[model samples]
Target: MTEPKIAIALYSYEPQEEGELLLLEGDILTVLEEDASGWWSGESNGKTGLFPGSYVEYVDEQLIESLGLEQFEEISEESNNTTEQDLTQQQGGEFSGQNINDENYVSDEENEKDNTSQNQNQQEIIQTQNFTRNIGGTTMIHDGFIWEEKEPVFKVTIGKTVKRKKLRGMKKYTAYLIHSGNFCVTRRYKHFLWLRQRLVERYENVPVPPMPEKQFQGRFGEDFISRRREGLNRFLNRICEHPILRSSQIFHHFLEADEYQDWKMGKRAAEKQNKKEVPFFKSITCAQEVTKDCDDEITEFKKNITSLDKCLKNVENVATDLYLSNYQDLSASYLKFSKAFLKLGSEAKGIVGKNLDIEGKELKERGKEQRKIFIDPLKDYNRLIQVFIETIKVRDQANFQYVSTHAKYTKQNMGELSGQNRDKLLLKQDKSDRMTNITLAEIELFHYNRLRDSKEILTNHLKTQIEYYRKSSERWKKVKEEVEKIPVIHGSKKLEGMEDLSEPELFDEKIETDTEENQTSNQIDKEIEKNDEDNEEEDDEDTDDEDTDEDDDDDQTEETEEIEKEKDENEKNEKEKDEKENNDDFEKI
Candidate 1:
């Protein structure tokens, strides 16, 4: 039997069965067998499953070879040019390519040779253009330093919960980046922590911004997750602003690498490169200075932790004393009241009394449960705060040792007379510096990790608080429903005189009805008045229009009369002229 070949996944596959593997896009998988159907059996991320064969493709050897050839040619050409230039300089004569008076010295044969060389160069240029077109104008360059200016765009989306081996189901956040190409990486809060740690380790001088606080209580809450997504966006934007860090190989791999193993390897390589063994003496002074600078921040952090501890304790005390204690007291009182009601000897009253007794007992039990819910989470929170404080104390102690050793080393270096004494002081300083560096690193790691844990503890406590209230509300709802179910028992009391109560109730109802009737009548009258006003306004407008129409009709009649008079005058004038012309013609004849 031959070993199965490996193939790269072109698209992500979410398996439907437990045995099936979850394959991310760009993941390398071992192909075991092929089925008659399009599905092929493959193993990825240590899980074997059937995947669609079309979703993956084998790595192409030709493409890899072409990429290598392009890089080799570029390097070879540069080296050849440098060698030619060097040889020309070593000969101590004018370079052959230097310009000269061609008319005075050059022959026809030399001119022909130059023209042929020029034609050859043009042909090479034309060939290069054709080659570029053949390759879709996108060249694959192998030089690691070759970088293009591309603005990275980040988008985050909350994905489905995924169950992993030996761990609780985790919610996935898929981060998509648009840079040279569209790249997507799915991660959780822990992955964010890992990235932050690496950034801090690699870029010591750069102030790495904090991530969204881990929330255990609302770890899956929509609003919290949204805020976290926004925070992640800001974090990436900050990372992009740094010149050196933005161009980092690891950073690029983190954004663009499709294969998880390849990305991890790149990160590991970056970390190794960043790791440096410091001279003990030099690092001791630096550590002391760092401790001094961080004093205020550390103190502030401690104060916050203390304040949080106190707040948690106060909440626990309130829940225990005010709520639980009150519930217990109320339960006892209700129990005594139930006994009194049972002694009344009415069946309905007895049932109500029994229900009240049950309610009291239930309330008491709920109080205990609520107390546990509040106190248990608080205890864990307090413990976490205590741990944080202790860690800070240890950090302070380490700083004290660094400062003390640094002072001693400085004193010895300043006053030492003998060579041996000076050497010993130097050795001590080196040891001190090494210890200081280690301690400082530890302190920083502790500080960040402690804050992260504190946030988780607080989140858990808040979740517990929410659960307590929810359960309490449910219990109260049940109590209310049960109380409503109990039948009321009638008794001979002064307040229960139906005839007297009926008169007042009937009077009140009659008054209410009368008031409503009056209101309706008033509203109707107002509407009628408004309508009358509107009608009057319309009538006035109509009257105005009638008057204007009459005036217009009178004006038209006058104009017609004037026009008829003018026509009559013109006709009379024409008849007179005709008569006169007839008389003149008769005289001429």
Candidate 2:
């Protein structure tokens, strides 16, 4: 029979059913039985029940003895500071069902070798069955990697942009659909900004991937949304992959909480927690022993990591430019080229045209899948590299904190560094060690991931290129075969849809129109001739009458003229005798 093992509770677990043990954080229990399932039979405070092995971490009895009364007293002080009821109200129900809250309430950074059995069981239960299963994790180096499974533990996909209104439509904004597993939540960009701010406040020394920069102009554009959503996805994936951050109560609420009210409550609690100025290092679990020589080792690792970061950044930048300029731009260009050819083929109408249309359609289809296979992977990897660089920076900050704390503590005189002050210094030392362990593990894990991810990305890149060329060749071959099937024709044939071009009918219509015009003109000419003859006859009659009247007047005038001539001759004889006498008398006067 195996001897009973003593374990330390890393979290507060409330029993959801009978036969379950209620575990308070930092409580010690005597473990009686172990199971391949995550449950273990344990006795604590004279009460015996079954508890999840993950809730309480098993400690070596000798190590516990070495920790002695100081550790217990510290635990007791924590208990006194926060009452049982307050702990329940504040943090009990947000355990994510069976999920552990290592950042806020548990120790998740324990050595994996110590909890291999429990770790296996835990991984079996909690998984993200997201469709992006191609993130290969099998056949990887087992050096402090957080995720054991081939895929990410949780997949956070942001899509389905919904324009929403708040406060009776007075305020409007876009909400992105964040779906992970069965639980989905809608969050705005502002909400993500708020989340980023709060996480940084809560975990100053821990790396929190920054969201994409905010922009007011064209914020709702499809391109901007796609870019921002992709960035947000990378942020969530980083947080999810983190050993410490993944266990955060804030992270859990952000991801799995589906209701608005629940989200608000969780948000308020996290913000409130942030205001307390609690040491972030206190919650960190330092499973590995931090030796004095670790600084040199850490320095060496830092040099390598920084060098790697610089090199990787350069590569990522080039890859991004390549994706934008080569893959994305070229894919669209190919599709456009295909569409123009297809249109030409459709317009031309022959066996060759049909082949062109088929080829164009097939080529156009390459754009969508090409983006999926090549562009997406490049983008994902580039974002991951950025996250890595950010983490390295934060890890340096943590190391700086530890160094500062150590320096100050050592500078104190021995007279003053006694009792409670000494105890406080010891706590600081432990916290520093924890900070180092966490940052180192995280850095190591990142390096491990870098190798695998680079392999996958390169593999995908090569595969996409090979497939593209192969498909193009195949399409040309298909067109060649199609061309070979074209039959030779002796004479020209009527084009498709041109059979209704009737030339003889057009000529007949023109002839009929000309004939109708000729008949109408002849009738008009005949009417004009008859009217002219009638007018000429009327004029002749009027002229003859006018001549008859003139002759009558002339005869009358002739008779009157003869009478006047006779009278004038008689008067002239008398006037001639008188005028001779008068002329002689007038000459004398």
Q: Candidate 1 lDDT, tens digit per residue, 451-566?
A: 76558656765786577568656766766776678566677354221223234332121122244333433433343344334334335577788979999999999999999999
How many clashes does each candidate structure show, in the order listed?
4, 0
For 271-316, candidate 2 gives per-residue lDDT tens digits of: 8656543345544433344554555666777677667666766765
Relative to the true structure, candidate 2 reaches a TM of 0.50
Q: Which runs in model 1 stand beyond 4 Å of their true positions? A: 1-292, 337-354, 415-589
TM-score of each: 0.29, 0.50
Could you say which candidate leads in lDDT? 2
CA lDDT of each prediction against the hidden true structure: 0.49, 0.56
